[model samples]
Target: MTMQLLLTLLLAVARVKASTLLASHYSGQLYTLSLSSTNQLSISGSISSGNRMPAWLDLDSASRTLYIPDEVQWGQPLLKSFTVGTDGAVVPKEQIQTSGGDLHSTLYGGPNGKGYIALAQYDASAISTYPLPLTGAGQPLQKLTFTMPQPGPVPSRQNKPHPHSVFTDPSGQNLLSADLGADLIRVFRVGTNGTLAECSPAKSGAGDGPRHGAFWTRGNSTLLFTVNELSNSITAWSVLYQPGGCISLLKRQTTSTFPPGKSAPPGSKAAEVRVKDNFVYATNRFDRSFGAQEDSIATFSIHAASGNVTFVETTSAHSFFPRTFSINAAGTLVAIGGQTSANVAIVERNVTTGRLGRLLASLKVGNPGAANQEDGLSAVVWNE
Candidate 1:
């Protein structure tokens, strides 16, 4: 190979080896940042969609593309796509209008080797599927609509079916959705053609608003845990595969996300949950009025054999309303984004001790919106 060709090959390998964190803001901007070998964070580049605030973000490493839902509360909703350049800059590729529904979450995965993006709409009470080259956006291939069969205990928040998050099972045979308004974890069988077949919906306690979940296998069992927004608790379930390839989620344990003898302050709600080996971490959103009292990330220690989790300790997120966080691919750094604080908090993770070190740095991300506005941070994603 020529000297220039060899140099290009080495550079490509180095870029792929570095870890990246993608932060989605509610101000219609998406920022790409990277963690260096010594754990320093630097802004790479960003892309914005005008005033169409981008909410949830999912990245396909193989395609080097990012997917987001245009959650314009006062305008039309859309699905936007972007290509991640070699320098970690995002370039707008395509966008498709989703009519009137407001999309809240999106996940990219499928069972039969077919790529797909699963979409959830909280306002429309629907789950839809879009086939992916993800090169260009267009209409969804199929949509499954739902209604609230019965009202949840919290009338104000659960009067309708509000699907908050959607993800495919690690087994690749089932698609699971956490419905916040209906208090149910809906499950669907993944078909070869990317269609969904109705399966048993995992029922939760009446006031337990299921928002997001994490799945992992331990021993001979597959485990799933969800963060409850309304009740401020965590629910653990054992995923069992039945005959003819069906699935069931049996409750294993339920525990408060708060520390022992401690109660969550008023207006505090759980936001996201993530697991890394023996340690699991989750974030909470609180009214900015509560200030430092309610802004925290609760940590839990998981029992390797039982699939049960114990509240470890609560760490101050160093900012307000930590809506989302991500652990880097090397599992050495944790990046947290504060929605109300409009900043990103970075903490070092001691993998050997399973304890997070003190705050190392914070990055201001977007324009600070009014108290009632959500124009701050929304999601944080990490990939190598």
Candidate 2:
């Protein structure tokens, strides 16, 4: 073979080897999947978590550590840590009991400049923080509970404060928790001693149910875009850095997660929200009845000056009830996991246009379950 052809073949092989994905399931399993350069997807390995439900995963690439939150409804859930091998498999390191019903978490710098995990416990109506480098099961460093006088507009879904997700701001000085039950985004200041002090919270529209959010920074302005699960919409907020380490959010606009002239169907809810280079992507679940047997991933463009968001289009998620989806580090591919369908899908993404092109590959890893039962896939993350 000519030298040019040999170099091309080597590059192709590298592309295939780089496209590994780590997927978590509600069935107590973590899977290592691979996507070929030609878009073929295959399961390479898996390990039983032995936990009730490992719902969310936060990866620390610098340390090659994976933090998984076990979401349990009744008993105390566990926060497990593992060392990810170079081959994409994981080895369990430690497990610590956390507050119940931990749905989502994020790793961020603590007050003392150490790594910390902020956990959002949905059922416990609390936010807990744990020190990094887990050694074994131990007490949380801090746990803050929330309460309200009465439920929001949707009493059934907003009976108490349910913190769905926890994330850090662009400066990493403040931590924000999206409380779905109370329709509020709670803010906390990271102190020098690794403690969190409560700051003023940002209130969303009644019944908006802010679940997950992403931050966008341009020049000196920072904007927050959140997917509201109850209202099936997205809200953009102008972030204001306060005098100290605290921050505030000024609501800008709210738009439907669906495309123009469209609305969510009955029992449909928005799931995940991710902000890429110049676009925002969110998942809508239970809306597959409109067209295909699959859910939809909605894309929106961010206005350069005002940081406003406008809906772009919607694409098939290639799975049913897509609860979570992750974009590759290159932003060239997306892996979506369906909760009820028990399927994982890979789709090509146009980084320039910020539009998902087509379904590349999909695989069924487990059996389907009911909508309410968390029996299938829960989350997907690129191993890179």
Candidate 3:
């Protein structure tokens, strides 16, 4: 069994089937990057405080660890941690806070079996739970804190409790949030120690500011899409998985990450809404980039008996403002990111006919405030 131990176990299964797509460019700080197959690419940045802003990132592949939600300045507002070493990269380590402040990180699946790192705390409309720490580094365990519900906008838009995005509900036991100034779509109950109770009120979309969302779990009738940046549109809903399940609003289209006549700004938004396998990607943050965040990945395609979303391909034309994207694991590759496209737009996923080719790499992340102010990029995937 020794030919150099079979070529180091065949290059460790060819770098785990050759996967490593990473992106996170959240503005002032947090701009990480990667892409592999021995292309061996690397880019990193870090800086914290000021606004702890590391925006969002999640990757828990059974504790390989990499979860972030830091937006802390004078303390209290973090859930940061990283450690994917062994050449798979990613290293930072610990940060943990979350008495609830500028939070917004995602990935939950731990009623106790392990894998929890959710947080969408707009100063406490709340949704924080940190348990992705299996003695890999420790220091996280803030556990329960769910309170969010003040929706029903209009008083100049309900003023506050804007818990942006924190989804999950395919009978994962519910925990869907998307409250841009509380326009609505909140439903929690996945407790065991990592808590969050409230329930119901899962529908609202007119000026539909409902931040990010996605879930089409192959269908049996479990669709759910939400990305209403103040009403640009993309609603969908229809999740009724009982245990106390029930979620309506089955349709709401109207998309435009900017490219059809264009025109968006004045508070600028529609940040993200990814869903892989059946295909679904969104991110429309024009906020003034000449009629669209310079065209940043709107591509859609899903109707497996009504999950609605048809518009296959637009990729911000050539890129610049995605702030997030993910869909790999042989589904090919789609890793994008945003905030002026700090860079990482791989595309290239023809896997048969899911369509999307060329531009196989756009890696250029390095300016999280010039070295690593935690670097601002918001989520990119493929660590699994």
Ranking by TM-score: 2, 1, 3
Best by lDDT: 2
lDDT of 3 by residue, 294-369 (tens): 5455667777766667777555424455656777665666676644646666666654456666665676665433
lDDT of each: 0.77, 0.86, 0.61
Clashing pairs in 1: none
TM-score to true structure, per model:
0.89, 0.94, 0.31
List candidate 1 segments past 4 Å from native. Answer: 1-19, 36-40, 100-114, 134-137, 287-294, 370-372
Please provide, for model 1 over 1-384, each residue's C-alpha lDDT reduced to its tens digit, 9 standing for 90 to 100.
987677556535543555677888787788888766555677777767543777777777767777787666466677877887655777887666664344554454454344777887777788888787544446777788898767789988999998888887777778889999999999988777778888989998888999998987777778898999998888988999987666899988878778888777678888889888787788877733335533788888888877788888877776777888888655667888888777788887766556777887777787655443567787777754
Locate the minimum summed-lDDT window of 10 residues in model 3.
Answer: 367-376
Cα error, residue 373 of model 2, in Å, equals 2.2
Give the Å error, residue 248, model 2. Answer: 0.6
Q: What are the per-model numbers of colliding residue pairs?
A: 0, 0, 27
Kindly report the root-mean-square deviation of model 1 from the true structure over all alpha carbons.
6.0
Alpha-carbon shift of residue 296 in model 1 (angstroms): 0.6
TM-score of 1: 0.89
Off by over 4 Å in 2: 1-16, 111-114, 289-292
Q: Is 1 or 3 the stronger prediction by lDDT? A: 1
Ten residues in a row with the worst lDDT in model 1? Answer: 285-294
The list of candidate 3 runs beyond 4 A from truth reads: 1-17, 21-67, 70-78, 89-92, 100-119, 126-150, 153-160, 165-207, 213-226, 229-253, 256-271, 274-280, 283-310, 313-332, 335-380
Better of 1 and 2 by lDDT: 2
